[model samples]
Target: MQALEKRLKREVLQNGKVEILASSSWCVPVQSIDVTYQPVKRLKMDLLMKMTLLTFQQAEIANADELSELLLVEELFIQDLLRNLTGTGLIEKGEMYYHLTSKGMMQLENGIYEEEQEQETQQLLYSACHEVFLPVDIDQMDEYDELPDLFRYASEEPDGSLTFVEEELIEVLQNSREPEEEGEEQTVITEILSKETQQINDIPCLEFILYDRDKDLLFARVWNTLLSQWDDKLEKQLVEKEVVKWREYYLKA
Candidate 1:
């Protein structure tokens, strides 16, 4: 039993990098280093960047103030980190929000520099999405218990209406669609939703509900319907101009 105890103590000392184990009669040195340390600023920056990237992975846009609150850091510190990250092309500032650029996404998926485990990443994704995308008054819904916070691109209007981006894209698509017969009108949301289900290229479609303080609207589209059509040029244009207008209406003063 004494031998077993001694072996366990040695294992703990080696694994923990502990320097000393004191006995009643003497102090025995276990390892050369007594402590491990990292610069406080560096540690803070590393954590900030990781959390920012994870947040961006879930939300289309994030701002420094929001990030600071989420990371429990000073707003000024987060702003500096964001500026530096933007310069490196890991983050892109869109109007009043910051988005994770393609480069940042690549680095995250490839496990560059600082990478979290798969399960950890998934947990972060779920939490971030819920934080940013779920309706603020979801608990008030009659079927709130049955609702799951699924991933989707949406923005909350100043009037409290949740607008699905894909629904806007669908409206655009519907307007541009040419009638199959002469003088025929384009398909409308009512016609689309009245059907049992809708599909594009054989892929199943999903319905999105835009909930407001007073009303709820239903929209239908397949996953990636809008994303697939958005090219780099269009994305850039939206980020530079249209997204600003969106922010103006969606974000409160």
Candidate 2:
């Protein structure tokens, strides 16, 4: 500090006035800059920039669904956030997850940053998925006994709804259907819901469930009539393992 003071005094005496630009005042315009002596301070926030940054920061560690939960914001907004944060290296994307970087961790830990409230709400849902099994609220057989009609339906019903995987199946079907059309082959979907039984709304129906064994994620759907075409070894594994549920078949990964 004393050396810096003496240098500044000497410069002032010599130049009469100090003009600092991108580097320290002592930096000569043509000289190489040595940032070793720079002071650390908080970043300045501009109003619009702050809003945009905060929006991205809230979604820093969120996947699509998680981002939706986090920001309760529109899909476009979340997409924008994903683009911004990934572009800036504040967060990283993976096949199935997003993660906050060290700088993000520091900002959160120091309480120097504030994110959207939706982030907290989505976090709760994310925690619930991590804690409880998918197809979580299985109406207890005994509990449903109070309503014999419901119990009877539950008994006849298979397990799982398979709602979440519907979109995935549709994408697959579309791709599979495209090439075959040029070859005079018709798009024939055998079945998506297993021949096994599944249940939805206490009713037995075509079985289907979306299960992610590694993540222990499950979403149940009854016969959407759309997934019947997705039945195959991969789809079968999803049901048999109970990693996904469609009727009687519980899929395991």
Candidate 3:
């Protein structure tokens, strides 16, 4: 908790816009689930989009009325498509014509059109150790520190306790996400089957009452000791889990 206090004073107090009112400690269990899902990938553009862009490239410069006749699509629909294209800055609309912008030409050069397709939507345990709760995703950090046992997954029934082989289950998510392909939409996970328990670790936290004098607002934020950072998502999760109460509950103090 020393780390939490030092960080809060150093990072928060220096800002004149905010001040720390009070703080309290609490323990929360965070679960790590090895989510396995089928990765369905596709480009952001669909067939019509590809056709529209190609039409622009072929015709070089054409008005919506001309494009509609050339593509054999309705003029109104073509107008909508052209409007979308211009809105995204891929194409520019001239006094009376629409043409592919340099950005649109680059998309064709990058093989984006070739990959156009459809996609659908898709969708840890806690252990208490030391005074600090370590996260199962500790592997994400560069420094392992000195605690070798922190990484080891406990065997079933270790020391006759409740078998700490990544104990318990909870609904939580960690990014462990894929690299974003700039401007390209990727496949979404429809559902999550299950996650293998890597290890059980506790998430120790300090809830700090923050006052934004500028806004005249008091809010609650949880400082994650394990991650050594203020995790807004985890703070919201804790509030949802009732680990932290509403601001009114804290202001009474």
- Best prediction by lDDT: 3
Tell me model 1's lDDT, rounded to 2 decimals.
0.37
lDDT of 1 by residue, 77-157 (tens): 988877777766787877766778787887666544331211200000001212222111212212211222322332222
The Cα error of candidate 3 at residue 58, in Å, is 36
Worst 10-residue lDDT window, candidate 1: 120-129
Please, what is the TM-score per model? 0.26, 0.23, 0.36
Model 2, span 97-124: residue lDDT tens: 5766676556545544323211100000
Better of 1 and 2 by lDDT: 1
Residue-level lDDT of model 3, residues 107-176, one tens digit each, is 6566453232243222233443222223435454333232222212222333213323212221122233
**Candidate rank order under lDDT:** 3, 1, 2
What is the lDDT, from 0 to 100, of the residue 197 in candidate 1?
13
lDDT of 1 at 179: 42
Kindly report which residue stretches of model 1 are placed more than 4 angstroms away from their true locations once superposed: 1-45, 60-62, 114-253
Give the winner by lDDT: 2 or 3.
3
Better of 1 and 3 by lDDT: 3
Look at candidate 1 and tell me the lDDT of residue 43.
Answer: 15
Residue pairs in collision within model 3: 31-124, 31-125, 32-124, 33-124, 34-195, 122-189, 122-190, 123-189, 123-190, 127-201
TM-score of 2: 0.23
Q: Which candidate is the best by TM-score?
A: 3
